[model samples]
Target chain A: MVKLAAKCILAGDPAVGKTALAQIFRSDGAHFQKNYTLTTGVDLVVKTVPVPDTGDSVELFIFDSAGKELFSEMLDKLWESPNVLCLVYDVTNEQSFSNCSKWLEKARAQVPGTSLPGVLVGNKTDLASRRAVDPAQAQAWALGQGLECFETSVKEMENYEAPFRCLATQFLHLYREKVELFQGLV
Target chain B: KMKTDLCLSSEGTEVILATSSDEKHPPENIIDGNAETFWTTTGMFPQEFVICFHKHVKIEKLIIQSYLVRTLRVEKSTSKEPVGFQQWIEKDLVHTEGQLQNEEITAHDGHATYLRVIIQSAFDHFASVHSISAEGTVVLNSS
Candidate 1:
């Protein structure tokens, strides 16, 4: 089986659980940060995700970055040529959700003219009492922007792996298509 | 173990795509085994070029000769297509002014039918790749 390495970029608004979700997934929900500190340049993590039935795996080199232009010029260097994207936002904050478009635009600018396989993550779902971004509304917008939508609460330790698994599966699907296209050319 | 120069044009390796294509300096210069002739980037820091080996090869090592490039990333695809390329290696090159930056990298047994070389960032506005030579073995699979 082929083990491919892909550069996965994690981007979102500040305090939207980008770091928490990433740490949880990397440690298989075992390690969660108690105190939140501002992410400076970039946090690089490597995880191997197996494609379910295909027997292949994608080694994701995740570049979890800061939110909303925090030392953004330095971020541009780390954000180059992302193979997969995870755009996160807080469910309790409508303003953070609204800024998804801007985050997406910035990520896409790194690799111009390329369709980046991405997922829109609505984080902090446990904050239902303060939920501002509607699930259905976020789903519709994600669909319109060619992104798969998934809502999860890192604090609640629920469904954190779904978005990453979806990205791994999607990357494998793209690989299969390329193999077919090359075989067709032969 | 035998080592083969997998990036040679004589070995059926062809450069399929390049972000910068100058009339005088072409992308094919990288595989021609001549350091004097080179492929120069036109406008940006993240310029790239694709080299198709036409078959699956497990690249053991790669030697790249370039100028002014600071950060370089290499990706590959087993499908031999322009699509589905995945990251293989990335390096932060040290710039020594007035000379070519010769980088030799170990591939960690990277297998690919096509390889993409990306100049992610550079010390200057433009960078030139003098040559790229890879040592590897070809695998034959019929599936």
Candidate 2:
């Protein structure tokens, strides 16, 4: 079985729960951040997600970055050559949801020539009463921008793995396509 | 259209993990592109060293310069990290009297990020691997 590692950038607005989502995913929902900790720079976490039915796995080097611009220069050192992206937003904050475009643009600009596989995630859906970003709207925008979309509440630990699984699936597809070229040699 | 040396230390490839290490003979010698410097196994059989490329590469062939290596095995991992290895190639070397045993193996495999070369058994108690080189092209992608 081929286990491929890809760089996954977790980016969104501050307080959008990108860190919580990543922590929950890594810890298997065993722990949640009780207090909001200001992420000053990039926190790297590696996890392997098994590709369903393929016996292959993608090791995600998830670089969870701070949303604040004060660390842009420092973040760039870790953000270079990202393989996949997870742009997160709070369903209760429209501004956070809209900023997904800018976050994605910044990620793509790091490596300009090639296509980056990514996903748009609408986080904090447990606050359904304060929902400001429509799921259908987010999904439509994601489709137009060639990104898959999903909604999850990391606070409630619901549907947190879908976005990462989606990214892994896309990367696995790219690996298979590239491997096909080498198959012709032998 | 052009093939490059994928195992050169000057080309961003490094020996991340190795089973044995000697002060005079380190695993880095395997990719240093110099056949004079070599990594010698201190003891026992089944010694291995892992080579990590800058990125996933489609190798055309792998060449190893060693002495007294009887059975050698090669494993490949596509993961960005050194994990999830699947067996790729295993070869029995042609032992030499006092000369270096040079074995060249071809590639009929997919893209690889790390290659683990295991020296399962040797003709002598200690074996030395001078260098290893892979002729391939890098798979260019954003990730």
Candidate 3:
């Protein structure tokens, strides 16, 4: 049995669906709107997913971090965990999308020397008319950062599984590449 | 062994505020073998209650059993206005399971005369005192 560990960082502006995105991905169809009261410190959750090839499961620990200024100090500690990072933004709110770069920069600075794999998520895609962020702009930003970009709707449960699974797939690919390179080294 | 004569008159439990200026409403500790004690009828001030230590001690935690009282505030002895003291005090919401145990702490400067428990706010239900326990190591502060 493969015992793989995964941790994903949900980062973006406050009230940008970072928490909603994580919950929807973790528990499919479990839609809820708890009080938007700002997350005081860090809220963490974990889910286990199965790997088809080995019939084994990997634990995915998700950190729904606070996006407020008070959490700046904690940002550094958040990056030390070895896992994929989901830089989430609100599709309906352009300001959240614009602030993605700052979140990524702060996360990268936390783990200065490690190669981090991450994805950009434009959330709340169900609200097309209210969208303040343009898809093209988000895609350009993702391409520039060498990361995959995805637009998701947690409320509608649309494309929720794809983005998280995409991160898992990328992790496997990265692991395989490292193994191959190490084999050649021997 | 001691012999004593006892008399009983069916008087209902009397309840009054702990802050009554009248000596008749003075708070008294319920003793194990004594006349049945009555509950305080009057409500605690928005921020006022008296504290009496059984013995000299440094209080570490104080648990408050209240009912329908939603908010709490405590004030230092010198300050007239009540300041929020809920954050500094560590507590568990006793009211979570349909029971009431909302807690708060009064300012405990080295020199504290009256440790007051204030009722900042309340809900539809009247607040009732179930129990209040103070835990701390005994120290020689007062004779």
Candidate 4:
């Protein structure tokens, strides 16, 4: 079984619950803080996910970065050499959803001429009554951008692991492909 | 009595300890006096490093160039060996993106042979210290 490690970055606008989503996935519903403290820099968390049937595991070093524009320059440094990306937005905030493209552009710009695997996540699904971004629309945009899409709610603990698990699976697939290519060349 | 770069390894300064060390970005970069080179933290919070000068010096000001640094605490020791550190300065730094944080702090009473810098916290998962310049004159009488 192959054990791989990769850097995963989470980016979004401020107040969009980026930190909450990360905390929920890391703690597995054991911890949740009600008080909100603006993340001025990047918070690092690590988690391991097992690939089904293959017995291989991937350890993800997740970098949860601040969403404030004032910290945009510092954010770029944190995005260095990311293996996967998690572009998140608040479902109830259309502006956050609309800003997804901008965030994606910035992340992609960091690694020019390379295609990085990523997911487009619409968070705050618990606020469905006040939702402004339709899942279908978000999914369509995500597909257009070549990213898998998922809706999650940190507050409700709904499908919080889907995005991370998907990333791990995709990374493992890439790792296998690289190993095969090297073997074939030999 | 001209000002000298007291932290330079070429000038008899030594990086005694750094909690997190990456081969590409070694702790010596902090005193290299070059902004292009840097030492990056590998993991976790409260990463720290110790710098020992060849002799006791009276530091007047310190300029640190770094990125993603949130809270920084500095201490000094006058003993022959690296021990008995006393708090000199502690302050929170502002975060700026796409640019290095050039922080200039006035260190009024930094008379010591060893200086310790403790990064209490950072704005991000990892932080980088590009360079640290200590402007002061060496104390001739204080061996």
Model 3 misplaced stretches (Cα beyond 4 Å): A29-41, A51-57, A66-69, B1-143
Clashing pairs in 4: A41-B123, A42-B123, A42-B124, A73-B97, A73-B98, A74-B97, A74-B98
List TM-scores for all candidates, in order. 0.57, 0.56, 0.49, 0.54
lDDT of 4 by residue, A50-144 (tens): 77787776677788764544476788777886778899999999999999999899888865655578999999988879999999999999999
Q: On a 0 to 100 scale, what is the lDDT of residue A146 in model 3? A: 76
Candidate 2, residue A180: the lDDT equals: 37
RMSD, every candidate, angstroms: 13.7, 16.7, 19.9, 10.7
**Cα lDDT tens digits for candidate 4, B1-143:** 99988889888888999987656568898897777777776544578999989788889999988887889999999998899999999989997766788899988877889989999976654578888999999995444
- Predicted complexes: DockQ each: 0.05, 0.04, 0.01, 0.02
Model 1 clash tally?
0
lDDT of 1 by residue, A73-163 (tens): 7788778767789999999999999999999999988767446889999999898999999999999999999999999999989999999
What is the alpha-carbon lDDT for the whole of candidate 2? 0.80
Model 2 CA deviation exceeding 4 Å by range? A29-41, A67-69, A184-186, B1-143
DockQ, cand. 1: 0.05
Worst 10 residues of 2 chain B by lDDT: B37-46
Residue A50, candidate 3: alpha-carbon lDDT: 57
TM-scores of chain B alone in all candidate structures, in the order given: 0.94, 0.96, 0.49, 0.96
Each model's TM-score for chain A is 0.90, 0.89, 0.82, 0.89
